[model samples]
Target: MNNLLIGLVRALRHHHWLRLLGGAFMLSSVGNGLTQVVVFGQLLRWHASPSALTLAYVLATLPGFFGSFFGEKGCRRVPPLRLLILTELLGMFALILPLLGMFYHNIPAMLAVQSVAAFLAGMSYPALTLTFKQGLSAEELPAATCMETLIFSAQVLLGTGLGVLLFEVFSPLTLLSIDAVSFVAAILLLAATARHIHLRPLQEMDTPPQVAVIRWAGLSILQKRSLLLLPALAAVGSPAMALLPAIAQQIRPGDATGLALPLLFARSLGQLCGPLLLNGERLRHYAKSNRHLLMCLGIFLAAYGALPLLAAEKTTALGLIFVAHLASNVVFALGTFSVLAYFPAQSVSGASAKAWRWQTLTAALATTLAAGLAAQWGATQSLYAVSLTSLAAVALILVRYRQ
Candidate 1:
């Protein structure tokens, strides 16, 4: 524990601004959690339809569709830190709109405002994703991935803890105010550090045209079939995430909001521990020598696929299954992060940030489909569907691995 703490302090000092950027990312996540706990929970008091919640998710995420396509190119032109600060500013309105809607008792107006905020956020993701990826050098990649893992874990655990505590004492508007302040502070931090670091730009590559870039990405996916297969499978497994809220809704009517923070906390715990276990020199050497990252992925997916079956029992079984499910989820998070970090730096392109666009596009489609499927079959059926999807993806990966 002392060693880990010392490593973390050293990491922050070594990459101070990037570390700040990671903190900024966590702050943004906290703002997201605030909205989830306060605004979304408040909105649920009105018995908002699952469709409405799903629509909100879509609206917030829609920017990724276009951003994935164009964001990489834009990042090439702009400084990453500047782009991140601009993104933080856009998120500020998302914090404010809910407060205004609450004062007016205007549900539709609030949703509309939130939707716009979500879109702006979506637009920002590609740029921010690239900037975060570029923040680390090749040697620091593992620790970088670990730090990222830590930040997200902290965001989930601390954000939820903070949201629950603050919401208990204050109004939703008050929480929104806090969120807005965080974004402003994040922006201020970036602005202060903006000019200090000289970042490498994609133009330094004298890269091929856009069309050729797409072809190259496509070929990379085809050639590195094991690498591509895991993310693709992971994408299809997204329905498992959607099922959480739906199941929580069933656990106690309208308690879906209550489930978000706790589930996020559990996920965070796993993510934080995962990097610690995976980031050692031995594993890195093993991953590089054998280059069989897919084997670990297969084991993880098998456990993920089994979670639903384990959860299907009644009473005593349900509790056991739930524990199993949560444990599997943590392992999944660790496995996925580890696999993603193994991709060669040379595969990264100016138009995309180290597989970010591809992963986002794949996840977007999977989420859309999973949301629809969940709506139709309810949460349990969706889990079964996810389990089956994972099996199929796992099968494909195994075949590709053999080749």
Candidate 2:
């Protein structure tokens, strides 16, 4: 434990600014976590039409669909540190706008602002991803990714907890205020660390034809075969996330907060353990590493497939759901690490961002479709649909692993 802590400290010391920037980036997520859960729960309580909630998801997730195009440019023109700082500032304003709406009794207006803020925040992820990518040595990539994952996990757990606690004591707006302060703190930390970092700009290369960063050209991103799996995976897995609120709903009225909080905590726990389980050394030494990844995917699929059954049979299965969700996220994170390892250094940031963009696009598209279906068929049915899709994906992964 002492040695592990020491290593983490050394890792952070290598690039103090990255540590600061990462912390800032993560802190902002706390606000986002609080804001999203509260809004989603309230929308459900209001009996908001599925279309309304779906529209919100679409608006927020839509920005990420084109993030790859912007990410490429952002990677080329902007330093990662500067990019991270700028996005956090944008996120700060976005968080504040909604707080104002909540105070003024403008729920729709708040949703609108929240949607746009989510879009910008989603777009910002790639730039931040690149920044973290650049901070690690080649040998440290897996551990670095694990550390990154752990940071995000920590954010989700703490953010969800804090958000729930504040919501109980105060209101969603109060949570939003606290979230906004976190963004400010993140920006300050990044600014303080800016002087210590020197990031390399992208090397000059032949430019691809200019494409709209925000414009969705029909089938433009879809043409990339490798990128296709990204969206497929996201689409198949995301509906289970919809189960989060339902699980919370089952616990108590307005108790969705408590249930969802633990899921996030469980996910973070898995993230923390996953790195320890699959360090760079293990990843490098494992024979048939692709098969290993496949095994993890299988674990995720099996766990996810059992969730509905568990929820139906066991009234107090939150603990089971937590373990299952944690397993799923760990597998997902491992898949992400594999994808990152496949990228060339020069392409890492651009590729990482674009991949995530594709994932979000597919997931959003899936959610929009599922939201409509859930309105009619029920959320439980929609979950089964997602599980079937994930099982098929797992099969494909296994087959491909064999090849």
- Judging by lDDT against the true structure, name the best candidate: 2
Best by TM-score: 2
lDDT tens digits, residue span 64-113, model 2: 66745565577678776677677777777776656665567556865776
lDDT of 1 at 159: 64
Q: State, as a TM-score between 0 and 1, how close model 2 is to the true structure.
A: 0.80
TM values, all candidates? 0.75, 0.80
Instruction: Give the per-residue lDDT of model 1 (tens digit) for 268-371.
Output: 45545544544334433433322344444344344434544553333322343334333333333333334335432223433334244455455556666666
Note the residue pairs that clash in candidate 2.
none
- Specify the poorest-scoring 10-residue window by lDDT in model 1: 345-354
Quote the lDDT for 214 in model 1: 36
Model 2 misplaced stretches (Cα beyond 4 Å):
1-9, 49-60, 104-107, 200-232, 247-273, 284-291, 301-305, 308-316, 397-403
Clashes of each: 0, 0
